[model samples]
Target: MKNFRREGNSNPVPAPSGGVVAGDGVLVGSLFGIAAIDAAEGESVEIASVGVFEMKKTSAQAWTVGAKVYWDGTNKVATTTASGNSLIGVAVGAAANPSATGLVRLNGVSI
Candidate 1:
């Protein structure tokens, strides 16, 4: 374990412009995570890099169980559209179109 480091389930990163609220999905550089707490812009915030989270999704899009999901940073929602979006995780449960939220399992790795 000479090269061991802390487990990366969560990580501390500077909040992006406009800050972040608790439970907000965040993309810092290439890392994607959910904010563990509210933090001001440029302040350090602990982001959960792995685990299942109920998050906002594109209300017009329907999601099926096990479908890959991407993070739409600008709109701040989970989406099935791949182009221009960052891969965040997969849908763990079916989400009906027009629903406000969806269940997602974090992949713990950047796209």
Candidate 2:
């Protein structure tokens, strides 16, 4: 139940997703990914939101996530995603040219 509020915003409101039953009041984090890169090139490693305050490397492929996402749950049961990937860490990729940004979306809730 750790909520990271953006700078200047002290509300620390809970970001819950709608339509997805697997998520609720849980927690979430920003979804970021590289864009514009060719599929033939070596892609960035995949990322997954491990709970609400940590991220883990789960794949060796590229992935994307909403920018608004900013929360993750507190259970390791659902450590990584099935297929899609989510960046839940503070370290961005070090590729020569990464997407840099993606749609900002909330996490914890389904999206």
Candidate 3:
């Protein structure tokens, strides 16, 4: 049976989805190279939404691989610097298989 659309019959608005897709994460790696951003704030960012934290290398530091991080961006506790990219992000994991039933950001325009 065809669903009914009452009202003035305007085009249906599309749902939000297909945000930044999380890649097969490293156990304890840096998120700095997670995704190169041309700019911050206005850019569309996505995380596990619920899982381990995704950490990114902030300074000239090298962290061990296979470690879980919450992609809290750089300088999370502090503000971003003009020279480096210290933007905060989210952490992701496999409790929800972001691939099988992966996570995605809704309302791309909203973000």
Candidate 4:
């Protein structure tokens, strides 16, 4: 394990233009990630770019396993649309017209 570099669960990234609170989704550099905790101006906060999170769903849309999920930055919700959206990850499960939230597997990736 001498050459092993620790891959931490989160990364310290500067707060976005509007600042970020705990559990808020953010677009840092080329990475679409989420704030692990609350942070203020002049401070670095931890952002998690991986793992599953219960994200808000834009509209009452049905989602199926392996469906491509996108992060709607404006609405702060997860959707299946690709155009003008940040690709987050895939839907881990199915949701029939999900109203509030749904499970999304975040891979910190984009198309």
* Model number with the top lDDT: 1
> Against the true structure, what is each candidate's TM-score?
0.96, 0.19, 0.19, 0.85
Show model 1 residue runs off by greater than 4 Å.
none
lDDT of candidate 1 over 3-77, digit per residue (tens):
989999999999999999999998998889999999999999999989999999999989999999999989999
Ten contiguous residues with the weakest lDDT in model 3: 102-111
Residue-pair clashes per candidate: 0, 22, 16, 0
Residue range 6-77, candidate 2, lDDT tens digits: 432112222333311222222234432222122222323222223332232322323343222322343321
**How many clashing residue pairs, candidate 4?**
0
Q: Report the candidate with higher lDDT, 2 versus 3.
A: 2
Give the TM-score (vs. native) of candidate 2: 0.19
| Best-to-worst ranking by lDDT | 1, 4, 2, 3
Please provide, for model 3 over 11-107, each residue's C-alpha lDDT reduced to its tens digit, 9 standing for 90 to 100. 1121113222233221112222222222233344332222223332333322332222232222332111334422223223222212222122111
For every candidate, C-alpha RMSD to the true structure in Å: 0.8, 15.7, 13.9, 1.9
- Show where candidate 2 strays beyond 4 Å: 1-52, 65-106
Residue 51 of model 2: what lDDT?
Answer: 31
Candidate number with greatest TM-score: 1
Local accuracy of candidate 4 as per-residue lDDT tens digits, 1-111: 898776866777888777888888877756777787888764798888889988778767999899999988888789998899878899997877846777888986555
Is candidate 1 or 2 superior in lDDT?
1
